[model samples]
Target: MGNWDHLVGASWRGECWAGARAELPLLLGVLPFGLVYGVLGLQAGLPGWAVVLMSSIVFGGSSQVVFAQLWGAGVPAPVIVGTVGVVNLRHALYSASVAQLLAELPLRWKLLLAYLLTDEAYMAAVGRLTSGPRSAVRHWFLFGTGFTLWAGWQLSTLGGVLLGATIPAGWALDFSIALTFIALLVPSLRRRSECVAAAVAGAVALLAQGVPYKLWILLAALAGMLAGMLAQALQRGKSHE
Candidate 1:
């Protein structure tokens, strides 16, 4: 019916805007962090174009920071690359979650969606698609959220790179980056097992702080993932008993 079509049409557009709006807060939260990254990247003597390209191409903030830090320290290229890969291994989880909603889409669309996938966008899109038709307006929502974030991140990084030198030393904004990660992790720590996994990870990272070649980050991540998976398995076994 014409009425049904009109209703679907309206909902699709509205859903996109709604999804974009939902991500607005996160966008604001990430802006300063991105700016900090840009500023630090330049201060560390990374090329301006390299900073922009890293953010534009890789589009992962944490990984970019690690790479810049290691590169500045004169670490080998392979070590820097490996460190970034380890830092971003968490994106695998996001890809798996988003892939479920996109299975029926064309391969081209799936590829584009995969490229757009990020921490905040994936989280928002997954929550929005709980009951909706997968094909209805999910991709639109994803596009709106992902596009907004992509724009914000690019602009913020550029701003930081251009103004890196003038930013005062007393701002103490670097700490905010760690605060942002804490905000992200706090909400994901609902279950006891998740909390334990996080605690174990924090302890390992601290203990391994003196390790060479930044192997501690990789070790900490693998140990945490294993501990969390084991906790879930044990919990499930107990429940089925």
Candidate 2:
């Protein structure tokens, strides 16, 4: 019995390590973005500790940037909270999608995974979950991936904060955030429905750019989701016929 238990533990650790290794490539894109956020947060007049604390607590890159930008610009606190809430609405969808796989997990485990769920982590985890045979200990895999990303984000943010003091304003590091998002987005347009959705979202965002409180982003996201769902339904109908 002892030997059997030891083997099981070893297998679990191996899976965790495999997950961490698999997530390393995604970190390449994430690291620079973290650095950019740290620098931007500092440049926006956020204290170094506050910037780092937000990265630790918030952990959402785009939303954090928006928060720092808006807060720096003297936006009211309630509006800042609302904007962050709207921006992170997609996490609800993410939670729903993965809820079944994680259903049996303890509440503590569920909470930890939920907190660690980010775009990069979700992309990596879902691909693993769907494309292969399910493992009994797959949650550990998620923990491994999430924890790896969490560490990377913290370290890179620290690096950025340290360097932010000396970095020149002329370097234009902020544009890199958009480019990073584009890189992440382009690869996910694998299906016709997804492509249409992305196109619609882009159009709506562009047309609604002047909307106050960054509401255009929320509108664009909703429009894209609806477009994608409609396209998928049409495809399903055609397939059944």
lDDT to native, each model: 0.76, 0.82
Clash pairs detected, candidate 1: none
What lDDT does model 1 reach? 0.76
List candidate 1 segments past 4 Å from native: 1-12, 133-135, 168-176
Q: Write one digit per residue (lDDT tens) for candidate 1, span 176-216.
A: 66687777789868887787778888889789989987667
Supply every candidate's count of residue pairs whose N, Cα or C atoms clash at under 3 angstroms: 0, 0
lDDT tens readout by residue for model 2, 132-241 = 45667878777778889999999999999999989985566657777887897898779999999899998998999898766676678778889989999999999999
Q: Which ten residues in a row have the lowest lDDT in candidate 1?
A: 1-10
Best by TM-score: 1
| Residue-level lDDT for 127 in candidate 2 | 60
Candidate 1 local Cα displacement, residue 153, angstroms: 0.9
RMSD of each: 4.0, 4.6
